[model samples]
Target: MAQQKPTKVMKLYNRVTRLPYGNKIFSLMVSRMAPYFGTIRPLITELRPHYCECLIKKRNAVHNHIKTVHVIAICNGLEMAMGVMAEASIPSHLRWIPKGMSLDYTAKAGSDIRCVAEVKPEQWVEGDLLVPVTAYDDNDVVVVEGHIKLWISAKPPR
Candidate 1:
């Protein structure tokens, strides 16, 4: 058997951040690699195969008509967290893509938001899976709840 290599996300996190700059490096890397993530400017607070967490500041760019974090911005944070989680957790031989998403805006987000995504190893199979993602406000109240459907498959021969 061939030696397994680290996932792209793991390599990027280790190489770019070097565990020194902390969330700053992660925010820069994610924004650079994925322009959409830049729009929301999320700072990753935690990243691992089983879990991923990110923070989105309450900036004018992401503000809503009511002077609160926009609903779409909250969704963006959720997706970013889920994307990182999937990249880090999925099996090396398998590939995954966001198939769809469902979200519920549960409360008003008046301050910085924290988004988290998590998945169990058993959930990784060649099929459709729904990953749970949640976003909370500074008060620790859930502001958003959602599930991102990911399509998993085997990578074709090079």
Candidate 2:
């Protein structure tokens, strides 16, 4: 069998990640593509098949009334990581969309947070794929843990 071509987003990530401030540039591009992601001002630190990592700074804009990072803001970061990872890792013949997310707030998000999403290689087949996601504060404390359920299916013929 022939090797499948990478998705457009994966190709763009590969090209941009080689330049200085490449990850920042890629993050900006992604934010522009999906303006809602711009709200968190996420910086994608890493991207590869089956995994993605993003950073969200603890700025006033993302803070809650009590002065800690808002849960929704962390959710946005988690969703971004999951979306990108699925785009990069899905089989060429398959496509995916998030169905829902189930998360638990484990601790206060008191500082900058790192969000991560991962999928096992064998989990890429068609059906509901639950991508595991987690967020940690600067002190490496788990602030949130969850899974985003994604519906994967074969792409329709042209």
Candidate 3:
């Protein structure tokens, strides 16, 4: 079989992440691509095949009554990481969409949070797949853990 080319999302990531202020540019691009994601004010810290990382600061807009990061905000961050991973890793022949997510709030997020998601190399395939994601506070405590399911399939013949 022939090697597949990188997806357009990955190509854009690679292109911008090479220049100065690339991270900022990538973040803006992601927000534009998914307007809902922009609401959480996420910063795309890393993006690569099978892995993605994002940071969301603790701010009033994202805080709950208890003055900690809201659960929904954390969820948004998790999805963003998983979405980027899926976009960068899925083979060119296949397309994917998030089916659902299973999540657990392990701890209170008292500070800025960093979310990371990944799919093992062996797990890449053409079908339903779950990508694991975890979020940590500045102190490195795992605040959330879960998986996002993505339905993957070959594009219909044009």
Candidate 4:
């Protein structure tokens, strides 16, 4: 099989990650492109093929009545990580859209949260792909765990 060209998103990430505060710049760019993700103000710390990680700071904007990070805010971070991971990992001929998500809240999100999304190399193919996601609080306790399902398909010929 021919080597797949990098997606525009992946190319952008590669270009920015080398500059000073590049991760922050990339995160801001993504938030601008997808306004909803700006709600959580996610700071992408790492992005690579099949993997992505981001941090969501604890703040009033994202806090719940209980003074903890809201579940919805955490979900937004997870989805952002998954979207970037898919963009970086998928073959050039393929495209993906999120289908659904299933999650379990494991603990209170006190303090900043680190969100991660991952997919095994073998799982990248046409059809449904389940990307595993997890969020951890500052102390490394899992606050949320789930999978985001994505429908993968061939891109239309130009």
Q: Give the TM-score of candidate 2.
A: 0.95
lDDT of 2 by residue, 1-158 (tens): 34557878889999999999999999999999899999999999999888999999999999999999999999999999999988888888899988999999999999999999998878888999999999999989999999999999999998
Q: CA lDDT of 63 in candidate 1?
A: 92
Candidate 2: residue 69 lDDT (0-100): 97
lDDT (CA) per prediction: 0.88, 0.94, 0.89, 0.93
Name every residue pair that clashes in candidate 2: none
Query: Candidate 4: minimum summed lDDT over ten consecutive residues — where?
Result: 1-10
- Candidate 2 minimal-lDDT segment of 10 residues: 1-10
Question: The CA-based lDDT of model 2 is what?
Answer: 0.94
- Candidate 1 least-lDDT 10 residues: 1-10
Per-residue lDDT, model 3, residue 86, is 83
Ordered by TM-score, highest first, the candidates read: 2, 4, 3, 1
How are the candidates ranked when ordered by lDDT, highest leading? Answer: 2, 4, 3, 1
**lDDT score for candidate 1 against the true structure:** 0.88
lDDT of 1 by residue, 34-128 (tens): 89999998899888776899999999999988999999999999999999888877888789999999999999999999999999878888999
Q: What are the root-mean-square deviations of the candidates from the true structure over C-alphas? A: 2.4, 1.5, 1.5, 1.3
Model 4 residue runs over 4 Å out of place are 1-3
Off by over 4 Å in 3: 1-4
TM-score between model 4 and native: 0.95
lDDT string, candidate 4, 50-101, tens digits: 8999899999999999999999999999999999888888987789999999
